[model samples]
Target: MSVHSWPTQSLRIRTMFASKAAEPALWRLLSIVTLLIIALWWLSAPRDLFSAPLSVTEIAREAILLSGVWAYVLLTLAIVVVMRWRWIERPLGGLDRCYRLHKWAGIATGAVVLLHCVLEWLPGGLARARSQPSADASRQLGLDWNAATQEMAELANGTMLCALIAIALLRSIPYRWFRKTHRLSALLYLATTWHALLLLPPQLRFTPLGALIGLSALFGCAAAVVSVTGGVGRRRRVRGTITGLEAHNGILEVECTLAARGLPHRPGQFAYVCFDPAEGPHPFTIAGADPGARKIRFVIKALGDYTGQLANRLAEGQQVTIEGPYGGFDFRGTAREQVWVAGGIGLTPFLARLEYLRWLGRRSPSVTFFYCTRNAATDPYVSRLRTLCTQTGVTLALVDSARQRPLDFDAIAAGLRDPSGAELWFCGPARFGATLQRAWRTTGLPGRRFHREWFEMR
Candidate 1:
């Protein structure tokens, strides 16, 4: 029987098995959060639950309240993670994974909060509507100041819910507008925290659950303050000047020399570069790093509004701020051979790795680099890449999709000295990576050996 035709094994099961090995870091994060949620729910459970029977509404209301608290905790944790703290990034696998978790937590928080709001209104909506005083009677009686304040707070909470849902669901919104609107969440979070503190049952306030909520709220507020003050990347940020700028086709190569201490970075890590204050910071992979010279290079494609305008607006000696040296795409582990697949701008990280290998001045592992480009003849970096590959003893395989077929696993694996033992490192479009990954599975390659850098932040 063929290896792909395992008896009684369904494709779904096979896919799950493969994913389990490939995404251990993500699984670890999910496991930790799941356990925490379960523990919190258990702790928050009422002691007299079985002693006295409660109505379905009572039970559901309690569940919704607990879920809301859990969601808030997760949201606070997500906020803390996004602060780009080095200590947190290391354990969480990388900054990319950290951001992935942040996005998931934000989405989960919005969903749970929405559910909580719906449940709160379900039991009382009709009764409240019928009992509300008439407009004339309300005017005659005058508004109750305390009730008015509570109503206003509720309105604010609802507004925040709508914003969170929109932020999570809408992807077409411009990043600048998205970022500016996202900052308002912190203020809304503060308001929600205040509301919870004032309204939660007094008996529950002294419990461990209450303490946890209080701490989370305090931490979230602190993070919000840091965010508002433009201190998100303050610790890691360094002033630099554009030492060189090179334009190739639609791509731009930028070199910066640091005014402060240089960031110690691994070969395949990335950094957030801020060239213009109005443009805001954008993440770019570090294509080269020279600690001695305090210089770093970035290869950026004209893919968006900020990057598109860079070639025209940027000039030598322009002051810039760089914050990071993030990501964990480094090739530190041992493998019999390495197969690197880079698609277009994804070649940035591999360029840095090749440079590092060249500096080593020793024959490294058997490396086959597949650079998939539109047209090899017109590729500006073709000669430069070939020179670097020669220096590092790497075999460069240029796949020109315009002339030939797209890259497939069979072609990539054919160059590998030991297909099973080789580690496959890919940096490219998500769909391209997914396709390659599926192909790898058909060949029964261990998913753990396939490493990919997820490039999309949104």
Candidate 2:
């Protein structure tokens, strides 16, 4: 069926349903489970929760404790998901999407933790000010190691807030410091676990809420152990040495030959690379892979401090560690005709796909590749791509954004022989992809037919 044949209402309905289906199933499941747990916890609580009048301080205290429980659960789940990304990558769509979820979970956890602290402390502060006579007796009664545990928990909470704020706001912080601070969260999490164990309301000890919290604590403990032992991505890590380096306008291509054991990866997947222990692991798409030669290549753009310094600091024989081959942006199981839109550095995955098609030595699919950049003349990879496209019989159009208007669905549809049957793949800035997706909506295209890779980790 042609796209033009669909009625407007039908198209709208189809798009609505497709968009709903496109939401990550794993994320939806996690969200539903979390909400269910929260509801159960509230329902299973004592009758006084809803039947009796409660003071503001008592209500706030309950809220603070509940929020802390939720935050710890989410934080632990985020750590487990991120550390074992491969397990969720396929179901979650891609590692990029998984990381995006991981980031959201982390931020949400931090915000809730902050809220818990404020709610717990504000009432105490006001109460102390209103009644100084009882403060001394209260202090005397609260003293001892349990009080110390509460203080330690508060200290850990403050440290976590500081670290999260620093990492979020200051990109220029030394990578080593960033990594250490990030890992320190695990230790702080352990401290909070202790606090929760000893200080949780005595009434909840025999209830389901307590069991759920205990399970979450166990999960968090296990994740912390894996993190502290550096067990993340252990199996995926492969030793390799840089064999060649090529610099292109603001991009650098590093070619590396791996050890005898190959790092199996599909086209359009990326890996986290660690060149220096201090610099930590940074993700880059695999531009090309040669299984026979046991070699893989990465196209890195000088967009940040660590990447900008790579060209200058990297040597030919420098050893590196690679951990992945993650992402599910592969163009398989789609329509025979595919439209691929790549923006600037976004071209890396397409290049990998093209290389894979060439290696397969079969007739290429009907693909229209629109490569968008500032200038086709100066883009170092354009010439290489042109040659590869010609040899592989893939249609290539270089769209110089400086000289031409941005690409729209109409422009893309002009080249498609069967718009309804063609899948659209996009990798670029999130805003650009959204623009094209909106355009696709008006063209009566199924939203599922549009595949986009979101590269933003933050």
lDDT of each: 0.77, 0.77
Clashing residue pairs in candidate 2 are none
Using Cα atoms with residue i matched to residue i, what is each candidate's TM-score against the true structure? Answer: 0.85, 0.83
Q: Give one digit per residue, the lDDT tens place, for model 1 in 1-458.
A: 35664432344234423433445466577668757766765676668765788866566656655766766787787687887877888887688878877766776677777776666666644213211223233445675533553465567567766776666545445677878877777777676676565545555666777788888888888888888787887888999999999997999999999997898999999999998787588899999988999999999999877789889999998999999888989986578888999998999999999998888786654888999999999999888899999888888999998899999888997788878788899998756777788788779988778888866564
What lDDT is reached at residue 439 by model 2? 79
> How much does candidate 1 score in TM-score?
0.85
- What lDDT is obtained when candidate 2 is compared to the true structure? 0.77
Q: Of the candidates shown, which would achieve the greatest TM-score relative to the real structure?
A: 1
Give the per-residue lDDT digits (tens) of candidate 2, residues 1-458.
Answer: 45654574355344433433344543576687579668867865788777878877657656766777788787776666666645566777888777666665776677888887777668455322222222343456766545677689889878877776666544456666777778777788789888777666666767888888888888788878888888877888999999999987879999999976778988998898999987788889999988888999999999877889899999999999998878888877468798999998999999998888788875464988999999887788888899889878899989998899987778999999888888899998655776787778678888778888867543
